[model samples]
Target: MGRQNRSRKRRDEMNKIKKARYDAKELIRLKKTLGLLDAEGNEIMKDIADVVDIKTAKEIKRDAKTREQQELIYEHQESLEKGQKVKVTNDKTGVEHVFNSKTLKDQYGNYPAWFKKKKTAKRLRKKQHSQTKNFKQAWTTVNVPL
Candidate 1:
């Protein structure tokens, strides 16, 4: 009886999570259809339909955090385009290091450290899985074929 109750509770929790996700997706869809939100989910500043309809939504205000991120991205892109060296501070070690623009990205194109690690692990796993079992003996026997 206790096991059954626990299972039922877990199922109910899962259903609630699914419903919340669905509701969020539906809200986004409705906002996009109404022109209240952009394709990237940014809100538009247009006046309400009842009030003086104005196209003030063109002026989107970005928070300071987003603005700083955009600046950083611009700097990185500019550095890459101009063949200039850039300085980067390591988050873990607090050490500043200079790197060439070409060295910033991996062979697979724009990928961060964590993503590179994940891809490396996945490749190794695939390689290990692809090896077949060997039936040959370590040492050659007299009857073994060449």
Candidate 2:
């Protein structure tokens, strides 16, 4: 009786692994058939679950981390556009860098010194004020009877 129980448990384990592998294959096929992935993405996804092995788990974890980093970068771009300060702290070096209009790197590895803090509005207002000051208006004093 004991031998039979052990053999049954081993069989169950084998069946579980088979089902898991089949499920992974079916899911990949569905993604491809449904047109849910672009050509490049489909190619990448095809290899995502090549085998239900230990490596698949590691690949999934790495992909998650990469996706999270991408989201952070996008948020930083939006904040920079709105003239907000962005700070970056490197993990290995533990160095903190503050970015502003005066110092910030963009997608093309170019630093734009004039990306923010634009003074055009203030300069225009100053010019208009100066022009108004130069114009002299004549005012005549009139006595009003109450």
Candidate 3:
């Protein structure tokens, strides 16, 4: 097969794999809703235990993080409305740049270096996919080297 055809074939296979996983998760959820399986996907027996929904520590932390981010966004909006200037310090030159609300939207210098280099959704997805065993197996099937 040509290079383009091979790539396309691999992409289709990956999509199929992803769809299968999604379908499997959906099926498990359906079974749980029907009371056939527990919340953890284990078989439910009247003798064993009742199904329960509990939040893990990770979920609690994630919720807190989202709340914090929302608060920050609100603060930023309020500051902007009050015509407050954003101050950003350059790491190299140690110079502070105060940006007005109008300039903040159009200028990137007012943001920190880490914020400026923040990964996009697509890039984050690609990075995560590359780390998965499925991605490795798919690439190998295409006769491509890691």
Candidate 4:
């Protein structure tokens, strides 16, 4: 009877492990669909989960906001460095604004003009500020002669 009980316990443990793996996979898929995973395959959901029990939901919300802001700042800085011209179309206004490297620098101090909108600009500023506080930050710095 003791051996049988031990075998059954092992089987139950295996099943629990399998279930956890399945749940992780499904959560990853859902996070990807929700745009919560970066290109490096880091899952924001996992980060949230790590802090969920210890931290308040409001803190998680703030972290998410900061993460998104940082991503936008990095993307804008990269586009500016690359001297890539971009066309932004406003769905509501149906107006397309073209921004080249020079125009971007002239308008937004090394950031793109499309990013100059009040909402985005505020986020980018916050992101840049946070990044400047941290050491070991690597950014793509490209110089193109126009």
RMSD of each: 19.8, 27.7, 18.3, 17.8
Off by over 4 Å in 4: 1-3, 43-146
For all predicted structures, in order, the TM-scores are 0.30, 0.26, 0.27, 0.26
Name the 10 consecutive residues with the lowest summed lDDT in model 2: 137-146
Clashing pairs in 1: none
Could you give the candidate ranking by lDDT, starting with the highest?
Answer: 4, 3, 1, 2
Question: How many angstroms is residue 50 displaced in model 1 relative to the true structure, after the best TM-score fit?
Answer: 3.6
lDDT for each candidate structure: 0.56, 0.54, 0.58, 0.60
Which ten contiguous residues of candidate 4 have the minimum total lDDT?
137-146
Can you write out model 4's per-residue Cα lDDT over 1-146, one digit (the tens) per residue?
34668889899999999999999989888777767887777866556555436768999877776776567567656644656677666588796656565346432334443455666665455445534544233332221111
Pitting candidate 1 against candidate 3, the one with the higher lDDT is 3
Estimate the overall C-alpha local distance difference test score of candidate 2: 0.54
Off by over 4 Å in 1: 1-3, 47-146
Model 3 per-residue lDDT at 9 = 89
Model 2 ranges with Cα > 4 A deviation: 1-3, 38-146
Give each model's clash number: 0, 0, 0, 0
How well is each residue in 1-146 modelled by candidate 1, as lDDT tens digits? Answer: 34668889999999999999999999989878888898788999876775334544433333443554454445444544645566667799896666555445533344344446654664334333323244222211232232
Candidate that scores best on TM-score: 1
The residue-level lDDT of candidate 2 at 138 comes to 26
